[model samples]
Target chain A: MASNKEDVKLLGMVESPFVSRVDIALKLKGVEYKYEVENLQNKSEFLLKYNPVYKKVPVLVHNGKPISESLVILEYIDETWKQNPILPSDPYKRALARFWSKFIDDKIINAARKALYTHDEKEREKGVEEIEEALHLFENELKGKFFGGDEIGIVDITAVLIAYWLPIIQEAFGAKLFTSDKFPKLYNWSQDFNNHPIVKETLPPRETLMAYYKGHYERHVASNK
Target chain B: MASNKEDVKLLGMVESPFVSRVDIALKLKGVEYKYEVENLQNKSEFLLKYNPVYKKVPVLVHNGKPISESLVILEYIDETWKQNPILPSDPYKRALARFWSKFIDDKIINAARKALYTHDEKEREKGVEEIEEALHLFENELKGKFFGGDEIGIVDITAVLIAYWLPIIQEAFGAKLFTSDKFPKLYNWSQDFNNHPIVKETLPPRETLMAYYKGHYERHVASNK
Candidate 1:
């Protein structure tokens, strides 16, 4: 049945939260596609040709056309596959979903990276504060079990990074940045997000992710020192 | 007749390219709404309450519910009104439109700012190179009269800043960063974009914008010196 779908191809890396977004969305939608993992240092010509602008992964090449940017790709997936809707049907609801998704991408993600990767104490503290503020804002928006009531929607897909990557990054740095006690609603959401059937199936092994990020972070810290 | 639509309120400023995006979209959609020009230095309580995360302008309050982020608001307006479709109907085309919009916002705008605003010659040169590279990519994407083929779509809305604001900023800073000879396609697009009836009406007066930006840039430069 899935073979009838379009020739969908994803150029992605397993450890990337952005890539995971496309992975989970495709899985949830029951879309069949070929996935090629790209090395950052030695990027494939396919990836380069597909996403010449950014040359970044999670590029969804549908048939001949390539769509870069995970958020954009998610929208493309939802629009193309009508089975399991990743976005809400209503306009207003969808707006709020997009708003929060962009918020997570623009504010929360960058701040989390700084908190985890910055070498200086003051800079790290600032980054931590910004993350806490962003997460606090997100915490208030978690009125229902999931970001969009019961359904795991657009915002959830965007926030998947916080669900999966945050733990590994925090553990790698030995920082309790995003604990259950700090942001209970988000913490709970992350737990629920990771346990989602499609998400669970698609996620990279935790130990592998931890080792990869740990080595990367240590190298980054060492170079700065 | 236009007065009886929805209770729409735009919390924005004249100078902001992002604000201009929402303005142009609303005008094109023929959606009448109240415009409250916020003094960005002293933000309003209403603005703060609505968009606590960014606390920035271009917040569209429709029927009391507020939506922030210019790109997100553009999508909301299109979906709700459905009168003049700002985005393409085809999923692939829509994805491409969105991809370009994201690129313009993330790459073009920032580089333009740095190219014009930075006092250092080397940094300014770097910014200019990045902006030129981005604009060159955009020039190639201009395959039709408009990005939406014939109708001005989401990419056009997102690119409105580059069309109008870029010239103003360049002239204000005494910089000839973007020129007709250099970027014939983008230059021509800007001309068409500015001449569009809805765009012509919505654009801030060139002299007023130049004066405002001139003072602002001078102060910024003086402070850095």
Candidate 2:
């Protein structure tokens, strides 16, 4: 399976949760790729051409073909390279993993994105309720160690990004929603996922992330105010 | 394979777009499932039991283990049944299908739902731009007849639901969006999909769906205003 392929490049920013999702996926599969950081405020021409639709970061380039969505890129990474496979071999199990991943992607994580900067009372509350309700289900349904039962897989990756990033966002915004006591299972799982060697090495330092987010939150607040 | 393996029941509503994605997948696969309509506004015990998290529609109950999320249900359908396969066996092809499916799911179709009901002009434009951008990609990327290439498949199901549903939604709100000239590929594809014998037989009539959405839209606007 080892072969020299086309030049692989990644268009992303350091602080993007969305970009981080793709970064983690690529690292997990041990696929070699060039990382080209994109400025979200002023996107590069290549980033714009590669991903004109959303114009978001974490756009992966493989043999000159660009796949923008993180989840999509994850699947492509797994498919194109056989080493360090991401998806399970069993079809049903794969489906289950994908389901939980989609659940996290579509609802819990996306819902939390809105809650981060929402200053309006009703909007913030709506976002909080959405997160709380979602976490309640996440805590209850995932009785096992990981979303993939005993194994740490793609769903685990999706959930982990939220867990780690959520706290940073919360701290930046002064909104403490994900308490250890409130979501014990999720809390522990987050710790476990972060502790993994691959995850440990790949993640940007918390202090760095926090510092970046501090400026981000201040800008957001000032603009809104 | 179709011996006596319990009943396959789908809890969904005609008005719900997420449920519609699952329905199209099921229909395309030719998998027989008992459709149990659930009104989300008036939450049902069954709905809660089947999907406690979102409590939304498009929950597929297979031997009592309920799987929610339309994309998740679509994957589950493809995995469980070998009849008419929705996903391709080739990994790269499968990834392409998933990429486009997730792309459309995240941006175009799902975003449109919020746009239809929002009174805010900015929010409305956000939704419209999302749909427009997605359609542009769809028209450009889909060089063949279907998003699935020659025949109908996952991307077809995803595209069909969004394109056709737009008109129904427009009818409901006394507006228009799905113009023929604007999105030639997606618009024409919607027609082909809707006109197919299988799709024609299964899909709800446009007039029926239009009438259903009209009342639904009016009530929300009146109350919200």
* Segments of candidate 2 deviating more than 4 angstroms: B120-130
Tens-place lDDT per residue, model 1, B52-148, is: 8899999999989999999999999998888889998999889999999999989998898788878898999999999998899999999888887
| Span of 10 residues, lowest total lDDT, candidate 1 chain B | B1-10
Per-residue lDDT over A75-165 for candidate 1, one digit per residue giving the tens place of the 0 to 100 score: 9999988897989999989998998998888899889888888888899999999999988988899988789688788888888888888
Please give the RMSD of candidate 2 to the true structure. Answer: 2.6
TM-score of 2: 0.90
Q: List the pairs of residues colliding in candidate 1.
A: none
Query: Docking quality tier of candidate 2?
Result: medium
For model 1 the local lDDT of residue A79 reads 93
Model 1 segments beyond 4 Å from truth? A1-5, B1-5
Cα error, residue B5 of model 1, in Å, equals 5.6
Q: Model 1 Cα displacement at B89 (Å)?
A: 0.4
Which candidate leads in TM-score? 1
